[model samples]
Target: MTDAIRVTGLTKRFGARTVVDAVDLRVPEGRIMGFLGPNGSGKTTTIRMLCGLLTVDGGEGTVLGLDIRTAAAAIKRQAGYMTQRFSLYEDMTVGENLDFAARVQSVPGRRARVAEALDRMGLGGRRDQLAGHLSGGWKQRLALAATILHKPRLLLLDEPTAGVDPQARREFWDRIHGFAAEGMTVLVSTHYMDEAERCHAIAYIAYGKLLAAGSVAEVTAAAGLAAADVSGGDPELVRRIKALPSVETATAMGAQVHVAGADAAALAADLDRLAAEGLSWRPAPANLEDVFIHLMARRPDPAEAAR
Candidate 1:
C-alpha cells in the first residue's frame, strides 16, 4: 500500500528546547497507527506537524501526498483533526453544532451533510440536545461527527478517548475501524495501553524521539526482552527480584509479580534461583507496556541530555 504520510528529520523546537527531535514516520494508506508516548513527550507536537497544523522547524515530508512544508492549507482541508478537548460550542445543540461545522468547512449540501453526520454518529435522536448536556461519550461522538462533516480523507485524533468510559471508548474505536474500512487513514495519539493495542500498529515516542514502531508482536519481539510471571505470597520476594542484576523491571499485579529483562539467559537464571524459594515461575509473553517502559527507562531525559 502507498503511504498516506511520509516524513523524515521532522524536528520542532520551543525557544532552546527541542520538543520533537529528528523523528521519522510513515503511515500506510487505509491503516490505523497509534501514537503512544508519555506526557510532554512530543506526541501532540508530532501530530500537529503531520497534519500541517504547526510549522516544522526542520523536516521534509508529505501528508496525503501534499508537501508538508508548502501545502499546509491543502493538507488541512483534506485532513480531519479532533483536538484533545471538546472543541465544539457547548451552548449549541448537537444539530446546530454540526451545522456550524459544516458551514465552517463550506461543505456542499450543508444541511444534508449535517443530517448525515448526525445519523452516522447515532446522534440523530439527540440532535436537539444541547452539546453541554451530553455525557462524555456523547460529546466524543459529537466531536467525531463534526470532524468528518467535511469528509476528510485523513483523521488526526489527539487522545480521542481520554476520560471516556471503557464501553464508550470501545464504541468510538468501532466507528474508527468502520472509517478505516472505508479507506480513511488514521493517526491517533493516546495513552491507554488497550487503545494502543487496538491499532494496526503503534509508534512509541519518548524524549522527543521515535523509539519504536511496528505491529504489537513485532515491537515486543524487537525489544529483546524476556519476561516471567512469579506467583507467591511473599512480598519480600518482589523486592529481591527487582534488585537482581538481570531484571530490568519488576511490577506487582495482585498476587503475581511480572518481571522482565533484556538478557533472556540472565533473566532465566535469576528466575531459576528464585524458583528454588518455592515461588511459581512461569514464562510470560512480553507485553506492549513492558516494552514501552523498558524503552523509556533506557532513554535519557531530553533536557538533561541537552545540558
Candidate 2:
C-alpha cells in the first residue's frame, strides 16, 4: 500500500519547551494507526501537526500527499478531525448537526450526504433526537457522522471513545475498521489497551518523544522481554517477585501474578525458585501493555532531563 502519511523530524515547541520533539511517523493508505501515550506526552500535539491544525516548529512531512507546511489548507480539506470532547451544537438535532457540518465543509449534495452519514452511523432513526439529550454513545456516533459527512480521506481521531461504554467503543472501532476497508486512512490517539490492539499498527509517544511504532506483536517482540503467569501465589510472594532484580514488572491480574523481565534466563530461574515454594508458574507472552509500561518506566521525566 502507498504511504498516506510520511513525516520525519516533526517537532513543535512552545517558547523554550518542546511539547513534540523530533519524531518520525508513517501510516499506509487504508490503515488504522493507533497513537498511544500518557497525557501531555505530545500525542495530541503530533496529531494537530499531522492534520495541519498547528504549524510545525521544525522538520517536514506530507499528509495525504500535501506538504504539511505549504499545503495545510489542502490537508485540512481532506482530513476529518474528531476531538476528545463533543464539539457539535448541543441545541441542534442529530440531523441538524450533520447538516451543519456538511454545509460548513461546503460538501456537495448536502441532503444526500447527510442522509448517507446518518444511515451509515445507524443514526437514521435518531435523526430528530436532540444532540444534548443523546447518551454518550449516540453523541459519539453523531460526532463521527459529522466528521465523515465531508468525505475526508484521512481521519484524525483524538481519544474518540473516552467516555463511551464498552459496547459503544466496540461499535466505534467496527466503524473505524469499516472506513479503513473503504480506503480511508486513520490516525487515532487513545489510552485504552483494547483500542490500541484494534489498530493495524501502533505508535507510542512519551514526554515529547516517539518511543515505539509497530504492529502489536512486533512491538512486544522487540522489547525482548520474557514473562510468566504465576497462580496460587501469596501477597508476600508477589512482593518478592516484584523486588527481584530480574523482574521488570510484576502485576496482579485477578488470581495470577504476571511477571516480566528483560533477562529471560534470570527471570526463568527466579520463577523456578518461586515455583519450588508452591506457586504454579506457566510461561506467558509479554503483552503490549507490559512493553509500554516498561518503556515509560525506562524513560526519564522530561523535567528531570531538562534539569
Candidate 3:
C-alpha cells in the first residue's frame, strides 16, 4: 500500500548549522503519528518539509502520494497545517473568520462550510465573539476548525495544545481521536508525554536526529532501560544506587525513587546491596518519560566527545 507520507534521506541546513539531518520516515494513511522532541530540535522544520511548506535542502519524499520537491503546491492543497501560533485575524468575529477562510479556499457552498466549521467545533454559540477576545482554548478550537475547513487528507499540528487548559486539551485530543476514527491521518508534534502516548506510534527527534520510533512499549523496551521503584524507610538507598556505574538515572516521585539503568543485573545488584537498609525495592515497568530522559542523556555530543 502507498504510504500517506514517506521520506528518505531528508536533510535541512541553515548556514552553519544542520537543523535536520538525513532522516527516513513512513507514515501510513489514516494513522496518527506523534512527532516529539525538545526545543529547536528541528521538529517544526521536518514538519514543514513534509507538508511542502519549506523546501528540503536535500532528500526525496512524497506526501499524500505527491512529489514533495516538485509538486509542493499540489501536496499543500491536500494537507492541513496548524501552525504553532494562531494566524486568524483578531479583528474578525469567529463566524467572520471561518467565512473568510472558506472563501479563500474556494470551498463550495461557502456559507454552509463556514457554519459547519463553527458548529463542528462547538463554536456556533460563540460565533459572534471577536477572535481577539477568545481565550487560548477558544483560539485553539478556532485554529483547528480553520485547518479542517479545507478537508485536507492529512493534518499536521505543530504544538497544537500548548498553553491551553487541561480541560481544553482533553477536548481537543478527543476531537483529534474522532478525526482519526474517521480515517483522517494526523501528525502531531507535542512535548507532553501523555499526549504522545495517545498516538498510534511515536517518533523522537533530538538535535535533528531520529532517536527512537515505535509503539510506546516498543520504544521503551528498545531503549534497554530497567527501572526499580523503591519506597520505605531510608530514602538514601536511592542515593547510594545513584553512585553505581550501572545506574543511568535516579529520580524521586512522591515517596518513591525510580532507579533505572541499561544493565538490569548490575542495577539489581546495586539495589540488593541496599536491601539491608530497610528500603523496599521492586522492579517496575519503564515509562515513556523515563526512556525519553534516558535517550536524551545518553545521546553523544560530537563536539564534547571529540575532546
Best lDDT among the predictions, by candidate number: 1
lDDT of 2 by residue, 64-183 (tens): 989999999898889999988899999999988998899989999999999999989999999998999999999999999999988899999999999999999998999999999999
Model 1 alpha-carbon drift over 4 Å, by segment: 304-307
TM-score-based ranking, best first?
A: 1, 2, 3
The 0-to-1 C-alpha lDDT of every candidate, in the order given, reads 0.92, 0.91, 0.88
Model 1 C-alpha RMSD vs. true structure (Å) is 1.3
Poorest 10 consecutive residues of model 1 by lDDT?
Answer: 232-241
Candidate 2 clashes between residue pairs 3 or more apart in a chain or in different chains: none
Global CA lDDT computed for model 2: 0.91
Report residue 15 deviation for candidate 1 (angstroms). 0.4
By the TM-score metric, which is better: model 2 or model 3?
2
Worst lDDT run of 10 residues, candidate 2, spans 232-241
Better of 1 and 3 by lDDT: 1
Model 3: which ten-residue window has the lowest total lDDT? 232-241
> Comparing candidate 2 with candidate 3, which one achieves the higher lDDT?
2
Residue 163 in candidate 2 has what lDDT?
90
TM-score comparison, 1 vs 3, better candidate: 1
